[model samples]
Target: MGKLTDAIKHLIIINVIVFIAPQLLQLDFTNMLALHFPKNEHFGFWQYLTHMFMHGSFAHIAFNMYGLWAFGTPLEQMWGRNKFLFFYFSAGLGAGIIYTLVNYYQFNGIYELFINAGLTDSEVLSILKSGSTNDVRVVNAITQDQFNKITSLFNTPAVGASGAIYGVLVAFGLFFKDAKLALIFFPVPIAAKYFIPVMILGDLFFGMTKYSVGNVAHFAHIGGALIGFLIALYWKKNQFKTN
Candidate 1:
């Protein structure tokens, strides 16, 4: 409701710098900043926090920064800068952890199937490392379908602020449940309480069924929302004073 608070401003500045620096400096920050599967060589512990500030495109960062300024400002104002930053990073790290867990679940199934089909761990690791098994010489009859699934899972790296923004969205709904809101996909005005849940449920459905239009990390979104809900629930019960 007021001018961009300190934490929000710093976050936006950092995101902008990180997003642009890659291009200006001709650096491949993705390898270090983007969240990757734990088994991947690119994976690192710092990525859990860094990935929050690394978005995919202009539109991606723009939308997330807008969300940060829009929903996160109110939260920062209420929670103070330190607590807000802690919550923001917590949600983001939690999202990455959950996203990785989900990836493990999905990829493990494929890995196990290949193993049962006579593919060795070394063969699977090679496939994952190469991001493709098409050229790899394997004795197992790796079908095109199976190859595609494994490649997709191994190659898909998540980079965005959507997770923490989703956390802010959850807090917004809890603190301002009656606030009228709408999404670009559905512009009709709706209450924040219902709107947030609908968005989370959509992510859940897509995450569960593996039916998404783009490279949307649905599990990360849901994970952030879940953590945000827990934090908000705790705060609300304790009646954290904003004043």
Candidate 2:
């Protein structure tokens, strides 16, 4: 416990503080800090970093913090504080970028659909701008409007540290490939290298297949993994050159 890396310690502390601040101060800190995808119009450039520290619920924070503690301390120890922080923020930022791009494409598709269905340009623009259609009748009456409203919410904010944690999981897999990890409350043990990738692939499959799971940003997980893998590859190449 005392051997935890400074990065991990500070991250845990901040997450805990953010989690409890709302209850203590009676403010909706998470909603305010969460990363609203670029299309939100309300999105700011800083949310990419801020959202990783904000979580929606107790269970959400618990799972994210647990993943961070389980995987992050070891990676931080190996990579050192500055490198770990860099990798963490990089992964989180990458996640936000990928999520925003995906949301933009989806929003455009919906926008085009609404336009094709004879909804006025203003109506479509209103949905894109505010994410509220204001009339369920319009949605029910026009299939395209329903689709537009549904996809508009996709542009809503994504809040949590899971993306960065997923990046840590990737780093752990690469550096501690043979380390055994056991699922929480389960007796089965699996190697970190294989386990983490499998989990990532599972997330990809589910993310692609299921779109209705509200507020879970699975593509951001993929984005984190991709960034981690690329960073690891770059370090390996540079190490070879240095040697």
Candidate 3:
């Protein structure tokens, strides 16, 4: 489409290229690029930025890149290249930060339970290191839930651009409040101001209830949307002053 701006084109190109490179080249980008939990051995500082370019499946990358092109083009046209790039990465980093904070709280809950179950600090650390406890005493001290949480916290790697795309979606809604949107479930179009909030609420419900059908990162979506909203709101308020 003629509306596809320069930055959006490049962003989509890079994402698709990186998404295919791993499979075609047999290179392992998951460990180096996907966002891993902070305590996980695969966690690295670069993951915050790199994770935005890594996706798990064809559907995952396709939908995210589509969202970027659909929503990001106008934002890039309005903000210019440098500012648009800054907003994109800033929203992504913010999404990662918030997602990690939520994970930390979940981990702390398990940490307390493990402590109460009589696992020593070192024993807990060992479990984190090895991703499991062979120690019978440690195994018997807690419910199956504890083990599952510990395993999930230490081993699950999040890979996708959904968080950052959610950011772009939020920005689109804010900038084009009256724009009509249609969803797959609801073919009838509605104004973006109404639709985006509903979408975000759906994600919140899913995240809080753990209502995912698979390995979905609902909170990351919420995080990106929130960050995008704040950034767009701030810019809206200060636009006159900046100009």
Compose the digit string of candidate 2's lDDT tens values, residues 1-243: 247678888998999998898889988854458787554556788888899888889999999888888888877766778888888989888888887777677567556656666778677656656645656545654566446545555456788888888888888888789999888766589998778888888888867775537657888888888887888668756763221
Candidate 2 regions off by >4 Å?
128-155, 211-214, 240-243
- Weakest 10 consecutive residues, lDDT, candidate 1? 132-141
Per-residue error at 221 for model 2, in Å? 0.9
Q: Write candidate 3's Cα lDDT for 30-127 as tens digits.
A: 88889999887789989989999998889889889888987888888788877888788888998888888898898888788778778888778778
| Candidate 1 runs further than 4 Å off | 134-143
Mind giving the per-residue lDDT tens digits that candidate 1 earns over 12-89?
999999999989989888888899888778889999988998988999999999999999998888989988988898
Model 2 residue 212 CA deviation in Å: 6.4
TM-scores for the candidates: 0.93, 0.85, 0.92
Better of 1 and 2 by lDDT: 1
**Model 1 / residue 178 / CA error / Å:** 0.4
**Worst ten in a row by lDDT for model 2:** 234-243
lDDT of candidate 3 vs native? 0.84
Candidate lDDT scores, in order, read: 0.86, 0.76, 0.84
Query: Candidate 1 vs candidate 2: which has greater TM-score?
Result: 1
| Clashes by residue pair, model 3 | none
